[model samples]
Target: MKLGIFLLAAQFEAGDQGTVLTSAMDAGCAAEEAGFDEAWIAEHHFVPYGLCPSAVTFAAMLLGRTDRLRVGTAISVLPNTHPVALGEQAALLDQLSGGRFTLGIGRGGPWVDLEVFGSGIERYDEEGWAESVDLLMRWLTLRRVGAEGKHFRFRPVPVVPRPLTRPHPPAIIACTSATSAALAARQGLPMLLGMHADDCEKAEMISAYDAAARACGRDPRGVEHAAASVALVADSRAEAVRELKAALPRWLNRGLSAHQTVDGRARTMRDPHAYTDYLCEIHPVGTPRDVIAALRRTTEATGIRRHLLFAEGAGRPERTLDNIHRLGKEVLPEIRADAEQ
Candidate 1:
C-alpha cells in the first residue's frame, strides 16, 4: 500500500497564497526527505477559495523544487477544459518532472467557478464528462487524436513535446460519484477517490470502482484504489483538533472558494455546511495514533490499496507544512514498515 499527500493551495484571502505556496514547497521537500511516494495538488480559481487554478503548472514548479516525490494534480477538472490543451500541459509537466506526473481528472462540481469562469456549465453533465475524459485520454496518450465527438473535435492534431514517460503518463480518475467511478473503471485508469464525507461512501465508491473495473475485463487489483481524506495529525489529539477547528469554517463553506476538501489534511469542505454530519465519520483527525487507527478502520471496511492524507486548508502555511512533517516523520514510517512486514 502507498501513502500519499494532497497539498491544497487555497487561493482565498490576502497575503495567504504566497505563504501557502511556500509552505507547500517546503512540505514537498520534507515529504521527499521523509520518503513518501506521491505529492498531489488540487486546483481552484478566484479569491479565498483557491489560488491554484493551474495544477499542472504548479505541479511542474513543485517538481522543480522537490526530488523523489512524484507530483500529481490530485485532480484537474478535465471536463471543463479543452482536452488537447490539458494534454499538452500534462505532457510538459511529465517531461519537466522526469516522468513523475500522474494526471487526476475530475468532472467538477463547484458552480461558482464554472459560472464565473464561463466554463460551459451546461455541459457539466455525466455524458459531457464521459466524452471529454475519453477524448482527453486519447489525446494525452496517443499524442494524435482524431476523435470527433458531439462536444469536441480535432483533425489529427499532434501535440508537441510528448511525455517523457513511455506510452504516456500514468493517470488517475478522481472518482467522486458512481457515474465517475464507472467511467474510471471502464477505462482501466487508477482510482483516486477524494473528499468522501464518511467511510461508507469511500467503501461504496471503491466497491463501485472495483466492480466496474472487474466488469470491464480488467483485474481490479491491478488498478490503484487510493483513499483521499482530510487529515490533521499532531503530537497530541487536542492540538490536532485545534488546527482543524481553526480552518473548519472556510474549509467547509461553498462560497469561500472552489475547492472540494478541508481539514488541511484529507478532504475538502465542498458544502457550505462544513464537516457537518458527513465529515465527523470520515476525516482522519487527532494524534498520529488516532489517525492510524482511523486508517486501519477504513482499510478494514473498504479494502483500500493506498492512503492519501490532505494537509491544506484555510490556515497558516507553516502550520499546514508542520502537520505534514509530523505525519511523515512520526506516523507513516511505522505504517510503511508494517506494510512491508
Candidate 2:
C-alpha cells in the first residue's frame, strides 16, 4: 500500500495566503524527507477554503522542490477549465516531472467559480462531468482529439508533447456519489474517495464500483483506488482529538462560509463542530498505534491500496508538520510491514 499527504493549504489563522502556501510546500518536502510516497494537493477558487487555486501549477512547483516525492492534484476542478487545455498542462507536468504527476479530476460544486471561469452552472451536473472526462481521456490517450459534447465542441487537434506515461499520467476521479463512482468505473479510472466517508461507506462504494466496472467489461482488480482520511498523531487518542476539535472547526466553518452559489440557490452547509467530531470518529486521529490500526482496517474493508492522509486537520503549520513526521516515521513502517504480511 502507498501513503501520501493531502495538502489542503487552508488558511486557518489571521495571516497572508503566502504563509499557508509556503507551509504546504514545506509539508510536501517534509513528506519526501520522511519517506512518504506522494503529496496530493487540493484546489479551490475564489475561496480561502483552499488557497491554491491551481493544483496543477502548485504540483509543478512542488515537483521541482522535491526529488522523490510524487505530486498530484486531489482534484483539478474540471468544470472551471477546458479539458484539452487542462490536459496539455497535465501532460507537460507529467513529462517534465519524469512522470511523477497524477491528475485527479472532479466535478466541483455550483460555486461562483463556474460563473467566474465562464463554465456556467450547467457543468456542475453528471452529464457535464462525463463529457469533460471523455474529452480529457481522449486527449491523454490518443494522438489527436476532437470534442462534440454538449459542454464543449472542438475540431480535431494534435495532442502536443504527448504524455510520458502511456495513455496519460495516472489519473483518478473524485467519487463523492454513486453516480461519480459509476462514472469512474465505466471509464476504468480509479476512484479518489473523499475523507468524510467511513470504512463501511467506502466498502459499499468500492463494491458498487466493482459491479459497475464488471458491467463495463473492465476488471476491477487492476484498478488501484485511493481513499483520503484526516490524520493526526499524539501520545494518546484524546489529545489528538482534542487538538483537532479545537482548531479544525474554526477553519472548517470559516472556509465553508466563504463559498457562494453561482445561481443564488440555497446550499446547506455542514455544522463545522459536528463535522469535526464525525471526522475524528471516522479517521485516524489518534496515537501511532491507533492510526496504523485504523488505516489497516480501512484498507482491509475497502480494498483501497493508496491513502492520502490529510494531516492538516490540526489547522496549524507546526502541528501539521509534527503529525506528518509521526505518520511517516512511526506509523508508515508498521503499515508497510502489515501490508507485506
Using TM-score as the measure, which candidate wins?
Answer: 2
Q: Distance from true position, residue 169, model 1, in Å?
A: 0.9
lDDT of 1 by residue, 14-70 (tens): 564577677766776777776788888887655455557778877888788887888
Once model 1 is optimally superposed onto the true structure by TM-score, how far is the C-alpha of residue 33 displaced, in angstroms? 2.4
lDDT against true structure, model 2 = 0.90
Per-residue alpha-carbon lDDT of candidate 2 for residues 284-332, written as tens digits (9 for 90 to 100):
8799989988888888888887999997887889888888899999999
lDDT scores of the candidates, listed in order: 0.73, 0.90
Candidate 2 segments exceeding 4 Å error: none
Best by the lDDT measure: 2
